[model samples]
Target: MTKPTSETPAEDGAALLDDVERFHRRFNVFPHEAAYVAVALWDAHAHLLDCFDSTPRIAFLSPEPGSGKSRALEVVETLVPRPMLAVNARAAALFRSVSDPAGRPTILYDEIDTVFGPKAGDNEELRGFLNAGHRRSGVTYRCIGDGGNQTVQEFPSYSAVAVAGLGSLPDTILTRSVIIRMRRRARNEKVEPFRARVHEQQGNALRERLATWAKSVQDRVAGAWPEMPDGVTDRPADVWEPLLAVADAIGGDWPQRAREACVTLVKAAQVNDKGSLGIRLLTDLRDHVMVGIDRLPTVAILDRLNALDDAPWADLNGRPLDARRLSRMLGEYVTADGQPIASRNIKTAGSVLKGFYTEDLWDAWARYCPPPSASPLLPLPDGADTD
Candidate 1:
């Protein structure tokens, strides 16, 4: 999404209500996911007129084909101001535009991998732009002008971004994006109708409302910062800085909830990337920890964890269930409060594991593996082999 430079912090906002509410209502948008979109597109709206400053870029990805990624983008297209639909542009032209620091409108790309089709690393140029869009420092490049002049210009960078595609994007992009994983609706489930004109009217109203709100609370947005969330320890400043700013601006339960949601969702996606954990990861981790493992040998404990048909040990780490990751994941399963693993934390761990087990992955463990009791973290008793 592209933002114009004319917007001011104190400018009156007349857009949020219609755009945010409409998008929220029309689709079964996930709360965390919807917030990301709202904020990014909100920046786009501000840029269009003259309100707030930069914002995070958005990406919407899904596990497989037919996960409604394009449909999600349809909603974004209406809400975001001056969105650049990448798939519609010719690849060479798009890269050239992006290469120029002044690439305008929001750069919206669809079927990105496919769009960069049939060429040797054809998409590298485009990727560079998307990578930079997330951070001001990240958005710089040198392009030879029409007169064959070489100029190094830093492109305008803002949090205004959104992309949707199958599964996860590349790490360079993923690190910078607030991703929304699109889901496939079951045969029995459905959301209300959102045709083009209807979506447009609804989105326009939202934009107007949010813009109005921001105008009214411009001071609050700049000063109403809230308490920072815990466990943002390992996150990047680029990722958290704007996020915290948004929270500070909102200054209510939303600030805390939004930040926590970002941490949880981002981490879950990372864990899911590793392919080691699953819904079973949460259920099994709880089962194993509760059952106890103080006296159980590492091998026996491994056996039990692998035994869950719901959670496969081999899939945990493509190579094997190594001691390090296993121990780390177990340790991370609980928070400082020692509560059962929250669903979101489990998601983050699973995402992280998915990244590791990407290639040459072994199939899941055989069914009905045993559960473990408490342990003293003992070594294997004899020559007990895990494989």
Candidate 2:
């Protein structure tokens, strides 16, 4: 391990983060440069978790097995503080471990899909733990003792958590995470074989250095309000704040690199988001189907939505989206004045029909959908002319 020779904390911090990034690069074939930056910053952030009010869980997710998801968690385990790698762990055991007086452990949860996947029956207890743990004061109330002697107790659940799994997580957990979509290495993307015996010591050395660097900048990180890139706001802002704070403290190409990663990954997640079918419907209506139209009758709206080859509206629940489904889905959203946007009677060419007025949808569009510029994340529905 090379010692940081710089006299200033910023200089030393930059050098240390660079070393961490390079170390991860040698072993992990990340999907993009942003993934490397995020992982490295996240590793450093774990050391300074107490400085921030909320800790974002870093998730390495893949669509199938053997995509290096577990390997990514393994690499992270060596670098975080008091790492507790949990697989098939009971909810009781996890919350107990987190609330231990020794200190909160950095949780590296592998095979997390099994706890949230189709075969995984309602594991609501574990789900609640993961959700509540994102904020500093988050906790779970548990009953302890035997029989009538049992009493309710609050267990602190806040901790730096990283999870790896075969598929996506629930929307609640996903919104609070820094998501890394991992893929299997191709023939030419060579990486050093990560054997625990040979490489764990090297990683541990880096971890120690990271801890020292984190201590040096703990105060600065605590007070940092790192500026976010354009279009990165709301939940995305919360998720990237800690990683951006770490980059700002380090002070190098990192600040620039970190923002770039923020934009790239946030956009990727929005484009590939599988949660909220209703949001998807709203975005589609605002961006693709309803373009340049003031009022669309229910029949016209259904035709446009169902025509989209890539959208799920055409085959939702084994049937195409109908008038009732459309109204129900749209009714789920409200206007700025807090009234639900519902279908109304539209008099079209002397014929009255049930449809939606563009005026009613404007507020929901502004509040729920990303601006039109970001709409390209999802391609225009199949063969529909945009011009």
Candidate 3:
């Protein structure tokens, strides 16, 4: 089987993505989040037996229970390659499984929060394996036999992983994953119940088709380099590359949906987990913007952030954060990598002084911060370029 071409119209590819979206719709997930998860699964099934440098982990996180996290994993178990529902797998057994010369199985890990939560110390070795297995060259060494006669055994640790649980994953795992934040179904929204006997057959059919498609396009995906959107870079780029390639190869609305999902979900993860104190302050400042003013002086911004009872800004190094400290912390946002995110400039109200435009803060929030709790902020009106 060869790669899909323009003349082919990608009927098989389109059908595959259609099944993926239907699979996603079977659960209660937010907007494009399900699309992202679906594409990640396609990438996962295709990823094994092929050499993609970074095999992204699909991380499903929810703030509370009964949010369909495990159910989503169950659906994934029926779809991916040789799925292993290893909810409580030991570190040794997991690495050993990956080392098997036959082939690596897609490890579907549920209730993963417990493994990486407050008692993470007990599972340090497991954490190490999860972190190391993101890239193609991942490996672990073990020793066997008596001390004097011991020999080191090399274990290939690269494999596709999907983890689902409550709360956040560790920073290491979080950075190396496409994080999907799951939410409980709303009163109005509903989905069909997942019955094993019925859904299993449906899921299995999709699985066989996916396996065939992946085999057909393995060479194409192996050499693919899908174009990334703005705001995607570095580790985020690495993790999403394979999913995007799979999307392009599928050749339909999937290509477009995949990019949208990539930008939206990756931004959410960056806001929620990966950021310096400065970026976080920018996120917090969104709540302080005034309608008419459209700007805030450094002093005013600091005061508002410090006054928040839940915020830690008031007692930074035993003193309230001041203008100088805030400026120093936020200096990078002004000209990061030759691109400005936000800036301090003159705002005249009978007196000229340095302040940040509310517009800049809004733009930064949309680009860098997590999604707002209530609703997504409307796009900036035309001609409000902060950069």
lDDT of 2 by residue, 91-165 (tens): 899999999999889999999999998688778999999999999899999988999999999999999999999
Q: Which residue pairs of candidate 2 clash?
A: none
Best by TM-score: 2
Please give the CA lDDT of all the candidate structures.
0.50, 0.88, 0.73
| Superior candidate under TM-score, 2 versus 3 | 2
Error of 1 at 293 (Å): 20
**Each candidate's TM vs. the true structure?**
0.57, 0.85, 0.70
Judging by TM-score, tell me the better candidate of 1 and 3.
3
TM-score of model number 2: 0.85
Selected candidate, larger TM-score, 1 vs 2: 2
What is the per-residue lDDT of model 1 for residues 1-387, given as tens digits with 9 covering 90 to 100? 123235634322223333354465466444345455344433433333222333455666766777666766676666655566767455345435545555455566777556433332455666666665554444545565667676765544443556776655666666666666666777765677777776677676555544445455555555533444565543333455555554445444545556666667666656554333443453454355224221333454466666656555766436657556655554444432344222121123234222111010111111222223443232332333556
Model 2 worst lDDT window (10 residues): 375-384
Q: Rank the candidates by lDDT, best first.
A: 2, 3, 1
The C-alpha stretches of model 3 lying farther than 4 A from their native spots are 1-11, 31-49, 119-122, 274-308, 312-387
- Deviation in Å, model 3, residue 356 alpha carbon: 23
Q: Which regions of candidate 1 are displaced past 4 Å?
A: 1-22, 28-54, 88-104, 115-122, 145-159, 216-226, 234-237, 275-387
- Ranked candidates (TM-score, high to low): 2, 3, 1
